[model samples]
Target chain A: MSQIPFTDIVANLPASVPFVGPEQIERERGFTFRAKLGANESPFGPSPKARDAIQTAIEDSWEYPDATSVTLRQAIARHWDINTDNVLVGAGIDELLGNVVRMTVPPGGAVVTSNGAYPTFNYHVHGFGGTLHLVDYRDDHEDLDALAAKAQAVDARLVYLSNPDNPMGTRHTADAVADFRRRLPTDTLLVLDEAYSEFAPEGTNPPVDPSDTNLIRLRTFSKIYGLAALRVGYAIAHADAVTGLNKIRNHFGVNRVAQHAARAALEDQAYIDALKNEIERGKRAYAEIARRHGFTALPSFTNFVTIEVGGVARGDRLLKALQDRRVFIRKPGVPPLDRCIRVTVGPEDQRTIFEQAFAEAVQEVG
Target chain B: MSQIPFTDIVANLPASVPFVGPEQIERERGFTFRAKLGANESPFGPSPKARDAIQTAIEDSWEYPDATSVTLRQAIARHWDINTDNVLVGAGIDELLGNVVRMTVPPGGAVVTSNGAYPTFNYHVHGFGGTLHLVDYRDDHEDLDALAAKAQAVDARLVYLSNPDNPMGTRHTADAVADFRRRLPTDTLLVLDEAYSEFAPEGTNPPVDPSDTNLIRLRTFSKIYGLAALRVGYAIAHADAVTGLNKIRNHFGVNRVAQHAARAALEDQAYIDALKNEIERGKRAYAEIARRHGFTALPSFTNFVTIEVGGVARGDRLLKALQDRRVFIRKPGVPPLDRCIRVTVGPEDQRTIFEQAFAEAVQEVG
Candidate 1:
């Protein structure tokens, strides 16, 4: 039988997934995790109002969601005090990352990102046949200055940075970030990912001028509003960037429940404040646990905490040991950072379970 | 201010929206339709079990959905008695259509579809810079023989056909479709969109055959399953096509609620039977109404019925009149078929409202 032929680019691309979910791990191992803390999901759950909105919208699942997502975008704009014209909502920051890459990057086009930054963004750049220039992180944070310089040197079309960074939970101060943005080449667009911005220190996120045409800031309901499963995220950019997104985005990509739920979640400020407090409590508890276990907890501005385990091999072993004891956690893949396991803040119960598992894993690995 | 430059293809493409959703129309008119018959939605709602699943999963909206879509794909595989390797689920048929087009159509490649067939498929083809070859419908049905000939003549990379066709609500027997599939060139990939398959008469859908290497069948929960708002759909093809999708697909595109709801919907055969019966009743009622109004109702295998309004101008006038009466229905865009207006089957109450509105619109247009 003749086989179906794929495009040369698709044929050459590897069948790779960015991150495997905990459910897939369980399915493969025939064992479920006792504490599902690996994926940085908010175990505190979505707002009660968001849940109510989802339930109310259940019966209307027969209709397609509004293509423009007008209400949700308006709500997001009001919350941020920005114009709706500057906001573009998508499935998640992940999908938005894919879109931005597809828009600017062509075959052999230059794009720059940190070596150990968000892999999904790199995956998208690769999928679109772009040449990726990787810059190494400095002092456990995304080195914005180095990224900007590299983009200039390579004449990159795009540069990516995630503030309140993942895996290491490190962040650059607002002034530092603003300085880096000003220093970047005018032609290169900066993708400032603030997925964890809500949990960052008050002044950690720079007050980006919406009129700044060269930068786009991505934020997510996944982290702060606690609606990751609904998959809603937005990018705040100039009107041209937003309009350019319309040229390529899946217009009705946002789900109806997501739209309603995200709007409600954005309105429930009290719920967000309460969740923030809970996350702070979890972070402190995790730091205490790390101190008691003889590991050094990295200074963090986000919900997750990362602790140094002295060696990458030892960190991997400890992570495996935690999984073996029914606790799930993830460590960075690159060196220096690979010596640490990143744990997201959760409810007291899951945190306690993670603490006990971490102690046991540390002892075993040691 | 300097503007970020887009890729050559992106710069060359026109700013176009594929479809104008009914919600946009309602927003612009500042009036809600009393009888919402456009967009071919089920209107009967999803299965009871699916509704319950969505409600139960509401609280877990903070967590990301399983990236693999394991449970839903497993259920789909079992339903078709095919291996899991043959199935790949996505946000919806719209997304899958885009993916298929991207992988098959290099820039300027030829794609074949009927003149006024599903515009979303055509939109995807255009989005990927594919040249579209349109064949006119024959006797108000998609001309399968003509489509095959066009595909051969154009050396098309992809040929799209919607069984139990949209806009016209017409279909051919399974044998005729299978014969047409056999006549297509081996190099041409056939995208058989069966979005309305569940509402089709018996023998309308070809038997599931995973060994057909050149054929890929698209199915959706939007129609018979009534989960359009949830945005879940699947493509069943040979393993090669299924595997190729991974290279370009958004891995976490399907929402969690959609996956759970679709799984529950697949298991609720009783609910599906009831929905099918309701649709049949609605179809008969519509046909009776058409006869009473001196219009001819076309033979339909799908959930909607298309009625001839004499000519293109009459059809346009009738549609406008219906809209003025706060009833929303759609007509095909092409010449001969434009003489008809298509109405979807809704719940009993909505259909009664539509019946009254149809009478008023006909009298006014006359």
Candidate 2:
């Protein structure tokens, strides 16, 4: 018999794009990747204190985590010098993005974003049946003026811009971000994803103000704080915007061990600082590999370096050959942006493996 | 300026009920509870092997978790002897319930549940704008026949049932559950919450079949497996139902530590069998306490006991007094059933503490 009817919007929508995990790829390829530098994860892991916290919190796993995430929220509030009301903790930036999209963009409403900004954000927008209006990146950085113009043209409810963006590691200054925020329609919410903000140059993140209503800045421990697998992220927004998120988010979504570990990670600023230095070195290593191979490596302010591969066809071939050689790397999906492969910064040994694999792939592809 | 424009549905939805965390209660009351027999958590904690896995996985937290949760799904699939396609892992039963509700019920569609069934499911139903039709619990067990009647009456898109139910801790026979499923309208999907099923009698769970399209069974590691704070739960459903869930759920929602710990927990069946024995002892402890206090403790098939306080007002008074005495416990929210306070079973000392506080509360309230 046919299955019961799904909601009209969901039923009409295509099945979610299936995700092939690295493990699945390993299973299919008949060998494990020698270096895992695909996803833009923090190569340097969490602080020892944070790891200790996870172990210590293991015994407390029987208890339900505080639904309000009181301790973590208070910690974040103190970090930003804002009230707890100004912070909303979620499972991750991905979930927060979905919540923000659901709260702002109504079904069939318009949203504007750089075409290749964050596919997951686009997924959420589409899941909610929101129409996305695209603005192409300017020189691999989010085109703030073009995004604002598109939002205004569509009278969009929301606009997305990733500073020190993904797939292409680039950034706009804090002043530029603030200027774009001011230019956007006041009624439109700007979702400024700063998942890599911790790695950006000085003054890249706008000064957070509790009363700021025009934008929300999303941050995660996934990159700098080095807790990607734990899935914790926060959004700094107006109290009302935070309240709007509360109306839709799962109350106990963030796990207890994650909350404790993240709080500890926050206290270990030195750990983050040292990791950034290491990440900066790793990024340089990736650039060096590209230089040696006669490919242009884009300037990066984030954890990964994007190397130009001449064209989409070359990029695809190189990516496949790298996978064949058991090196994991990713590239941008849509074009004008698809002519490069993005490699996450890794430790020295992993970088060496990636470099060797890259040389081999290039030899075969060429 | 006023807040950015929220979607009409979210704007119109009730300000999410303010959650008063148990920690906040302790803070306000100026003391911590001596006994933490609330929230239906397994005080037994996770297995030693699972905890070890949690510690071991802490180093891997720098990487993003496998988005599809492949290995954990494989473990669960083997445990049930079902196809991996039939299993979908989520952060918790709470999150899974929300996803299932979102996928099935449309705006203004009807969903049937017991009046005092799982509130989180009701929250999700209302959040998605589904009109809830309540059928009171039959002797504090989910009234399956009444639920079926309501679903038929309203042409409901979904019906929620918790065998070995929460709060009241009563359950229906497997034969009854299977019969109800057979009689249910094919169009109305039964959301079978079996979170406490592991603590149930050997034959209590309905035999699982991968082809079952009319219902989906949800299980959690929170109860007997003792991993509530890690937020791991899984649903065994028809492959089509599983595919529908994939269309909207957060891909990397389950965290890395949880994935490893749950896999380990699943392997340690000896730990589960032992916890069930401990839970059985704790349940008997609650019954003995009820006997001494002249209260009727509901016969429980799960880990907790519901002690009747004679009336809703009395139950409210006893609950508050117990809280004042630094004893954390919970009572049902709605009336008729609200005459009882549900106490999650704890260890030997905790059960004694609960009995003493419960006696004190009764004396003061009387």
Candidate 3:
């Protein structure tokens, strides 16, 4: 049989996947992890109201979701005190990022991001044949000045920044982010990913200004709201940018149950507060566990902690040992960040499992 | 503030969208439609087991779905008697189409499809800046022979065909589709969308053969399984084609609840059988309604019926009258086909509403 003729770019590209889930790991090893913390999902789960709403809407799965996502968008807009036109709901932030990349970056166009930042955004940029410009992190956080300078230098079409960033679990204050946004060349679109914003400290998120057209802020229900399984996220930007998303976005991408559940989740402020408290507890426990193991845990505003293990090899060994003992954890790919293992904050039971597994893994690695 | 610089190609492209939903129309008109049949959604709803599964999985929504989608893929593979490697699950057939298009047709690459078949597929083609070669429907059905010829003539990277087709509600037999597949150029990837396959006649679907590397068959829960609102679909093909999808597909595209619900839906054969029966009953009722109005109901192997309205102008007038009477239906966009109105099958109450609106619409148009 003759091979199908793919485009030159596609044929030249390797089949590189962004990330493998814990399920695939279990399938290959023929064993399931006792605790899953590798993917940074909230362990507290969704609110009772959100859960109930999903249950009630389950029977209506046969009908296509409202294409406009009216109710969810309305709730989101109300929460932020913005117009509904400023909100664009999607399957998730990942899908929304892909759409944003497609809209701004064509083949051979330059897009900028930190060297070890979210790989999913890089994946989308590469999928569209865009030229990716990488800037190194400064002090375990995204170097905003360097990113902006790089974007201006290359006349990059888009720049991606995740506050309370992943992998290292570090963050920039709201003023720092706002200054970065203001300094960026107007021709460069800034994708300010605030996926972890809900868990950040006071003054972490900049005051909402719908008038700002240069940057698009992305938020998700997957974090503090605990609706990661529902796959709903929204981008808040100027109306034009939001409407531009309509040109390429899957209109009915957000599922009906997700819409209903997200609305319910938005209303349950008490649930979010409780989740924040639980996350704090997990953070403290994780810090103590790290200290006991003679490792340094990075202060995190997000729902995960990154523990520096002294060396890249040690981090890798620790991760493998933890996985062998049925506890899943992940490490960053680039150094000096590679010396750390990232662990998600979860309930006390999960933290207990992690504590026991971490001790064993550290001894085995040593 | 200066506008961000988008790619030249993106700037040149028109901001065209795919189909608008019934909800948008109702919102614009300031009233709900008495009978909602525009988008071809199943009104019978999903199976009780599927609904229950979604309800039960709701609490887990706070966790991100398994990116590998193991359970759903296993179930699909088992159902089709194929290896899990040959199955790729997605948010919907619409998303799968976008991924396939991205993989095969790079910017300015040629893609062939029927002019008015599935607008979403065309939207994806345009989104990727592919050159579209459209073949008009012959005898109210997709002309496979013409499509094959066009693909060969243009050396098209991909060709799209919807079996038990949309818009016209016409279908080609399994033998004919298999023959067409055999005749197509080896390099041309054929996307055989069997979205409505469960509602098709016994011989309408080609035999499942994972060995067939050039043809990708898409099936969805949106039709017979009644999970459109959940947005779950799968593509079946050779391992090579399936693996190619992993390179660009949003790994966590399908929601966790959706996966569970779809798996349960797959297990409930009785529910699907009942839905098929209801669809048949709806088809008969619609046919009778068409006859009473001196229109010819087109033969359909799917859940909807298309009726010839004598002329495009009259069809437009009738459609407006129906809208004015709070009935929602759709018509095709091209010539000859534009003279017909399409209606989806629903429960009896909705059918009665459609019947009353149809009569009023016809009288007003006359």
The number of the candidate with the highest DockQ is: 1
Q: For candidate 3, lDDT tens digit of each residue in B23-111?
A: 88888999988888887878888888987888678667777888878899999999999999999999989999988998888778999
* Model 1: chain B TM-score relative to the native chain B: 0.98
TM-score, one value per model: 0.98, 0.98, 0.97
DockQ score of each predicted structure, in the order shown: 0.74, 0.71, 0.71
Real contacts retained, model 2: 0.75
For model 1, state the Cα shift of residue A42 in Å. 0.8
Candidate 1: list runs displaced more than 4 Å.
Answer: none
Weakest lDDT window of 10 consecutive positions for candidate 2 chain B:
B15-24
Can you write out model 1's per-residue Cα lDDT over A1-366, one digit (the tens) per residue?
655756677777888878888898888788989888877878888889998999899978999898889899999899889899999999999999998988888888999999888889988988888899999988998888789889889999999988889878999889988999888878889899999999987789998578988899999989878898988999999988888788888877898999999999999999999888889888999989989988888988888889898889998899899989988888898876898988988899999899888888888988
Clashing pairs in 3: A62-B226, A226-B62
Model with the higher TM-score, candidate 1 or 3: 1
lDDT of 1 by residue, B125-237 (tens): 77777899999999988999899899889888899999989889999889999999888878888899999999887799999998888899999998889999989999999
Kindly give the stretch of ten consecutive residues in candidate 1 chain A with the minimal lDDT sum: A1-10
Query: Please, what is the whole-model Cα lDDT of each candidate in the order they appear?
Result: 0.88, 0.87, 0.88
Residue A273 error for model 3, in Å?
2.2
